[model samples]
Target: MNTLPQWAELLVSFFIILGASFTFIGSLGLLRLPDFMARLHAPTKATTLGVGGIIIGSMLYFSLSDTLSLHELLIAIFLFLTAPISAHLLAKAGLHLELKLTDNTRDLRKKPEQYSDKDS
Candidate 1:
């Protein structure tokens, strides 16, 4: 078994704690937020970032412990790639169903004349 240097271990532990805290915050937001749209924001943004932190910490820990490899790299890549797409798809499905939007949601309606020629 390999032991990490003091600073590297400290950094890794910090990342892990930060990641767990963000994840907890995300879960709390999901439970306490008033509406669906508001609730969706927590997991998509906070949780993704939280997971990213955990992955980065894992990568650092493993890389320091053994021969550096791309296993953790691939997991991080896949996670960063998929989280947004999943969130977008869920939002689109909700929109297509005409689900209730939070009062704070920006009004999407706009006049056709406001569009630039490039937008037409």
Candidate 2:
């Protein structure tokens, strides 16, 4: 059982707390915000960042005491790589369905062809 030094422990704690805060805020946004588009922004952006921070903190904690962890690095990498792709897919589905957007939700382009993948 290795004990982390004060500085390393502090850094790890900071990252964990920051991650938790962002995750909580993102969850709140998802629940409270009206409409799918607004809801999509919350989890994709904030939750990804939150989880990344937590992963980084885990990496730091383990790396400080042991060899650098492949698990944490891989998780962070996969998360960052997938989040945007998932968000894009969800948005495309929403557009395909022509889901209603709240008035506060900024209007998408007037023309769908510009962004849509449909063939002429």
Candidate 3:
């Protein structure tokens, strides 16, 4: 029977705490941010990192146990790949629908004007 070194255990605990804190912060941001775009960024970025960290910690903890486990890595990879795409599509759809916010900082999806040659 092999026991994890004290240092390894401490490291794992630290990662778990860090990941939990980030996820909490993301949830708070989701509630606190005033606007939709700003709110969208908070959860998408922080939660992604938080989940990634937890998954890595789980991978480390399991890898040290002799039996190989790739489930955590696969989940993390899928999450990293999909989260951004989902956010982008949602933002694009919002812009297309001309959703207006009470306090919009800047209009990112301003339509480009078509120039005509007859305009001198």
Candidate 4:
């Protein structure tokens, strides 16, 4: 097997570590957030980026060897494309089901007239 140079090795290690850290933080947010809508942002955004980072590291490591690796790139592309759509679907479903929000979260779905000065 061909060996990676010191710089490449360091870069790969950095990506892996960064990815793991983000995944961990995202998972923690999922568990600790007050409600479903509040929690969705953490995993969908942070965790997706986390996996992307690890995929990038894997791609770098493999591409530097005897052959190019397309699997990681495909996975990263699929993930980037799907995460937002899936999160939106999930949030839409939650809203349709009338999922309750924490008191601190304002419901933007309210009718615009509710904000009018005429109400006073």
Measured against the true structure, the TM-scores of the candidates, in listed sequence, are 0.83, 0.88, 0.83, 0.89
Record all residue pairs in model 2 with backbone atoms less than 3 Å apart, i.e. clashing: none
- RMSD, every candidate, angstroms: 2.6, 3.0, 3.8, 3.2
Instruction: List, residue by residue over 26-95, the lDDT tens digit for candidate 1.
Output: 9999998877767889998888888888888998898888978678788888988998899899887876
The segments of candidate 3 whose C-alpha lies over 4 angstroms from its true place after superposition are 109-120
lDDT tens per residue, model 2, 1-120: 799899999999999999999999999999999999899999999999899889989989888999877698888888899999999999999988989988888766677687788888
Which residue runs of candidate 1 sit more than 4 Å off their true CA positions?
A: 107-120
Clashing pairs in 4: none
Model 2: residues with Cα > 4 Å off, grouped in runs: 109-120
Q: How would you encode candidate 4's per-residue C-alpha lDDT over 4-82 as one tens digit per residue? A: 9999999999999999989998999999999989899999988997998899889989988758888998888889999
Q: Which residue pairs does candidate 1 place in steric collision?
A: none
Q: The CA-based lDDT of model 1 is what?
A: 0.84
Task: Arrange candidates by TM-score, descending.
Answer: 4, 2, 1, 3
lDDT of 3: 0.80
In angstroms, the error of model 4 at 109 is: 3.1
**Which tens-of-lDDT digit does each residue in 1-120 have in candidate 3?**
567788877777788878888888999999998777777887899988888888877877777755767989889989999999999988888777786665554664453443434554
